[model samples]
Target: MALHFTDVEAALDHLLARLPAGLRVAAPLGLGKPHRLLNALYARVEADPSRPLHLYTALSLDPPSPGKGLQARFLGPFLARHFGEDFPRLAYVQAMKRDALPAHIEVEEFYLQSGALLDSAQTQRRYASLNYTHVAAALAARQVHLITQKVAREPGGDRLSFSCNTDLTADTVDAHLARGLPRPLLVAEIDPQLPWLGGSAVAPDGFFDVVIDPPGPHPSLFGLPRQPVGDADYAIGLYASTLVRDGGTLQIGIGALADALCHALVLRHTDNARYRQVLAALDPDLESHPAVRDSGGLGPFEVGLYGCSEMINEGFKRLVETGVIRRKVVDDAALMRRLADGTANLGDHARLERDGEYLHGAFYLGSPDFYAWLRDLPEVQCRAIGMRRIGEVNQLYGGDEGLERLQRRDARFFNSCMMATALGAAVSDALEDGRVVSGVGGQYNFVAMAHALPDARSVLMLRSTREAHGRSESNVRWNYGHATIPRHLRDLYVDEYGIADLRHASDEDCVVAMAGIADARWQAGLLDAAKAARKLRGDFAAPPRWQHNTPQRLGQSLAPFRRDGTLPDYPLGSDFTAVEQRLVRALAWLQASTATTSGKLRIAWQALTATPGRDDEALRRMDLHAGAGAGTWFQARLLGLALARTARDH
Candidate 1:
């Protein structure tokens, strides 16, 4: 009578009997392998050829071309087979980071309506402005049965045909029972997160009459490329830090710039420890947590931080484990006690208070191990926040609050733009004819919010230069036709070279200020171009010392710190394999020095001789490929060819 493996089939059958006939079920696009219940449904669909229940999915295949990414890998072949050839059934995934929306959604109606004069209510009613909204509507119209790996506690009513609450632990089961599920349910008594710790509880442990302890599928994995912080990043970090009141809340996105902003805070504490200390003492629990003492030499200003991001990654956990985010001054002990009991929401448990504001992050990405730790934490005051709320709060409380409210205030916002011109336009990605590479997600919202906040500031991080023709060139001077945030809105721009404050500045001042932070190698060229175009009113010359402020120099300066473990620049929970790590380091070295001096050439030759792996081959081949025409690479390759010929002659 006990729920066991045999009970699973029976339990599923019973649930199926209760469901309305001909109901179709769809799972989250990326949710791993089909459960036995889903497998059973597929078998039923195949056996009953007449009433084939169609499963509408958000999954899609990568484009046939090389540039197109992978598709249908997350879901099992069962769903893929049905949707692969079937029109209208689709799967959705992130095609690009600049826009939160999928690439396929046609925004023509939204764009066309922007031109028309319509009331706000009418506009809201008519426009499906974002891709996700379309996804929701699609599912709703199909009347499709949807299942999710992690369902938001309440996703409205009667939409789901079947839900498998698959947690088997005692506590998890108890939690599930309390929720009082009225829908058709197929419960699996087997533990879903068994290999992990005890704190990770599941929902509704005893409600399932059938238990299936079958091996769980592998979780989806993602990769993140390591990028260096540049001049523009430094500027943004500094300005954004200014927005961070001594003990305010923070919600940061991931990337090199995010890392840079954190590093700048470390640097700020180092530069002025006393000021930071005074700030920290104001917090309720000033001297308790280890993060204040252990994390990267943070001083008295060891500002307690809580995360509020959608994607919780290793960086956030590391901050907690290492103690940068553990210092909490609980305002409501009863609420904390509720979280400890695991009865409250998961979001609240993750919220950490510092100074006065609660710190919570809604965005993050990490390995299963990292998430397991988060899974155990009590939901104190944390909540899963969305873009709509993000836009709303930022617009409401940004800078209007007093300094006390501001410092304990969550006023700073850090974001990135793809291209920012001297003329005040920003673009997240390149635009092509009649098509947008990226859609406006929350940039406009955040910018507007920053402007609305009394103490808030919008800091834009960018690099001074980019690599081209086997050499680095100033990105500031590159000709761009796209714009996302315009020049007039530009506040603080940071690169590895330096920071530039551009708000309300003349175009010339903006260009000069921006040029000052350009890689020293390209500073003169930028200045000369500005002069030629009459963009600069005064000095046409830049000092040689300033000209050397390239990414290469910044990396060189930062390298020793990394080697000694003084600076933790490595990506948290690395996606870099061993071979990739070597390639990354070698590539960084190669980019750092352009010297074709005899000593440098000797070193390069030795490296090629000693390690003739794919990495070396790729490096050599890249040089040859880039040198195919008349450019710097061509000159370097030609010289090498000449030197080889002379050696043969000798």
Candidate 2:
């Protein structure tokens, strides 16, 4: 039987007693990192300066900054003012932001919940750029002497289940045990709120050395709500969604881009005519890429996709509910074949046997609403989503190759990258000079999986440019030193402009292809750099058709659809009311305008002209009845922001 503790300090004291100095503690990435245990461990390590605590994990969430300057300033106050007490202020956020973390506490991140802000420098220096599949191997080499994870009890028994994160823990233990390594210290923090999922859920009494059942619910800080998908993100999503085959397996990353893709896909499945309308707007030559033209069509799913996503978010849930994400794949070969042949029936679970799970996820953290939905699900219903070790889900080449093949047939591991070299290499986390913004999560694993599965393809989405400090910086560059996915593994790359089909393309062609998709403003600089470096001839020019890849063109194309409300910032749907939706539209337009000098001037001029009482469309765009409840606050703020911008411009 495991020793039970009333408090974190005492529990960790017992845990520390079993371990040596210079401890390497491993845990599941994301929400699975037991915050209480970590706080206690941090305090314990703080007291002892000689022993350095090496911590390894991935996708660690930090306190989200609303954004830069005016956006963060105005939006932060607005959210707090509107939501009031309902707004979340997570304490774990400070762990990444502040300097309370001791120097001896070495944090090694495998991934980051990226949103332009990278808080810690010490953690960045200790970053490990390993594929998700190799995370276990790396841990084992260090003789990972300790493991602590969050788990849920079986209502009454000592048997526990690793609820949110089965990703790294089980596989690490299994690998260690198979190699005859001494069992690491296992500590399980029992939280009642964690949903008990099946498939490798059960753990015997002997598995854990200590169990700490906390008094309160594990604090689930709502994940950064989906970012607003503006014209750029929508355009990217529109093109990227075209690459998704109806019958294929889908893997997506988090944030606005994923949400945008989900919206586009839902449109494709439920309303193809509307989907085609928006996609055609993105590229007049929608048939340019044969794959997007043929395999990717505007139609409902005849063969619904199976999801082997490493991380499941609100988008996945929505997809599931809409029946857009229904095809199930387990380890069984026959079931995989059935799924491929459009004969697989999930209702017949007995006949449609599973070797592992239908959907293998590591850890999940979404909005509070998303979590509430997850918590309310029945055990049988939850069976469809099986949380597995990160090692297994991240890498498909290991262990059962045949089984993985069947489970991940037609796999499209769609992920985001910070930048990509014109020659087709990708940069996900860090910059070229070595400032780590985020750690390389499962991007390499998915890229590898895409390669391992002959039918699969890695669809990496690189937004053309991200506004940083009010300047648009291109995500496509001449070359980047730090590569998340090397040029060799290059597959399909997409940006707001269009798709770059670089697979099997020559270096010169890769340059042309990448340039074609990059933001038009930045493409010249990229090409100039390439020419200076002798990679391209001085006379070389972007393909004639590619010259149409301009933001102005994209905006013009999307103009008509904006009025019909087809290309919305939140395409799937919005929980916000009509009034709130208008506010969202206006606020987003205001924030986005900061990216361009001309845009700022135009918005400033418009704000200057609009008087408060009159029914200005700009005012109406924010809200119709501007003096009611939250709308009252929005009206004041909107006017104040306009005034502020006008004065600032002067």
**Top-lDDT candidate index:** 2
**Full-model lDDT, candidate 1:** 0.42
Report the Cα lDDT for residue 593, model 1: 42
Model 2 — TM-score against the truth?
0.84
- Candidate 2 structure quality by residue, lDDT tens digits, 1-650: 77898688878777777788889888777777676787677767776888788887776654445674434544564455433434334233355566456767767766666643355655566678777777887888778888988887776565788877777787788778877898788888887766666566566557888889877534654344545677778888888888887777889988788888888788788888888878777766775677676446567888677777778887788787777887766666666667557786765465454333445677776765676677777665577787766666777655777777877767888998888999999998787777777777778778877877877889998778777867777778887789878998898998888888877788877887888887777778888888887778899876676677777888888777765767665654554545444445556656676567887777656555655444344344434335567645544555545534423111
> In candidate 1, what are the lDDT values of residues 1-650, reduced to their tens digit?
32445344665565566565566544432222133454555545444545345443322112121121011111222233322332221121111112322222211222211112132222223233333223333434445332323221212321111111111122222333444532223343233432111111223333334344444442222223344544345444443444444444455555666765665565555555533432232222323322222212234246555443323345555555544453343345454555435575655555533222233322233444544554465444222111111212333442323322322234445666655565445665334232343344345545655566554556666666665555555666534666666566777665555546676678787777777666666666667777777888665566565665655655554444345443443434443444333334444444344344663576456544442223334334324334444554433443333233222111
Could you tell me every candidate's TM-score relative to the true structure? 0.54, 0.84
Worst 10 residues of 2 by lDDT: 641-650
Off by over 4 Å in 1: 1-149, 152-243, 263-311, 321-357, 378-410, 432-439, 528-535, 538-545, 569-580, 587-650
Residue 57's lDDT in candidate 1: 35
Cα shift from native, residue 345, model 1 (Å) = 27
- Deviation in angstroms for 94 in model 1? 13
